[model samples]
Target: MIRSAYSLQAAEAEIPALSATPLDVVALLAQAHHPEAGAVVLFSGEVRNHNQGQDVDYLEYEAHEAMAEKMIAEIINDAHAKWPLKIAVAQHRTGKVAIGETAVIVITSSAHRHEAYEANQYIIHRIKHEATIWKCEYFTDGSKKWGGNCSCCPPAL
Candidate 1:
C-alpha cells in the first residue's frame, strides 16, 4: 500500500541527513509544479539567533530518519485526501543548522489559492507536532538545551 502511494509521480518527500547539503527552495518549488494547479504555496522554516531572551548560536536537529520520512509521507498523503491538491513536497534538514539557515521547507499546490494556503498551513503545523525531529539549541553563553519547539517555546520566567 505504501509502495503504491509512494510511486506517484507528483508527490515528493525527503529527510536529508547531516552529510546532505542545505535545502534549495527554488528546486523544491519546481518539484511541486503541476500543470493543472493554479496556486503554489511555499514555506521555509529557518534557524534564528535568539530564543526566549537567550542568545542562541545555532540549532542541531536530529531525526529518526525512517520514522520521520514515514510520518512526513503520511502527512502529505493526508493533505491530498483532505484537499484537491495537485502535489505536495516537504524536506527537513538534519544535524547542525546555523542561524539564518533553513531547517524545513514545504510546498503545496492546488487549483485555488484557498486550498493551497490551507493545505500548506496544515502540512507545516502537522510536521511540527507529529514528526520525530528533535532539536537542541546551542547558546552563545556555552549552554545547551533541548526539547522545545521553535513555534511554542516556553516564555522566560
Candidate 2:
C-alpha cells in the first residue's frame, strides 16, 4: 500500500510510558497504508532518567517551532526522496516531560518491511541530528543544563 500523510505537534501534557498511545501516529499510518504495502515501521523516542551518568529528574524542551516544523517537513521530504516510502509521519512533544515518557515518534510505511524499517531509522536519525531544537535537563538536585547546544553534546549532522 502507498498512502500519504504527515503530522507534527508540540504540546504540554503528561507523556505516557511503558504502553503509550500515539494516536496521531496511528492515524497517520492508517492513512498511509496501501493495498500493496506489506509492512509499517514506527519509531518512538522516550524520555529516560539518565544521560551521561547524570541523574535526570525531568526534561524541558524548547523550540522555534514554526521553523522546526518547516525543517521536519524537509526531513520527511528527504526521506521520501531517498527511499521507497508509502507513507510517513513525524511528531515530537515539547515542554516538561518526566522520566520514561515518549518525546518523539516517527512512523513510515512501505510496500515491504525493509523500506518501512529503513525510512523509520532515517527519520529518527535526521530528527536527532539535524532538527533545529534544544533541550535542558533538570536533575533531582535542582540543577538544569542545556543539551544539543553545547559542544559536549554530539555533533549535529
Among the numbered candidates, top lDDT falls to 1
User: Model 2, range 3-116, lDDT digits (tens) per residue?
Assistant: 222222211112221122333545544555555568878776777787777789988777777777777888887887888776677777677877887678877778889888
Q: What are the runs in model 1 whose C-alpha is more than 4 Å off?
A: 1-19, 150-157
TM-score of 2: 0.75
TM for candidate 1 is 0.84
Model 1, range 1-157, lDDT digits (tens) per residue? Answer: 4554455342464433222468887877777766677999999999989998999999998889889888888888898899998778788888889999889998888889899998888888888877888889999999999967656633321
Best-fitting candidate, measured by TM-score? 1
- Per-candidate TM-scores read 0.84, 0.75
Model 1 has an lDDT value of 0.79
**Whole-model lDDT values for every prediction:** 0.79, 0.67
Each candidate's clash count: 0, 3
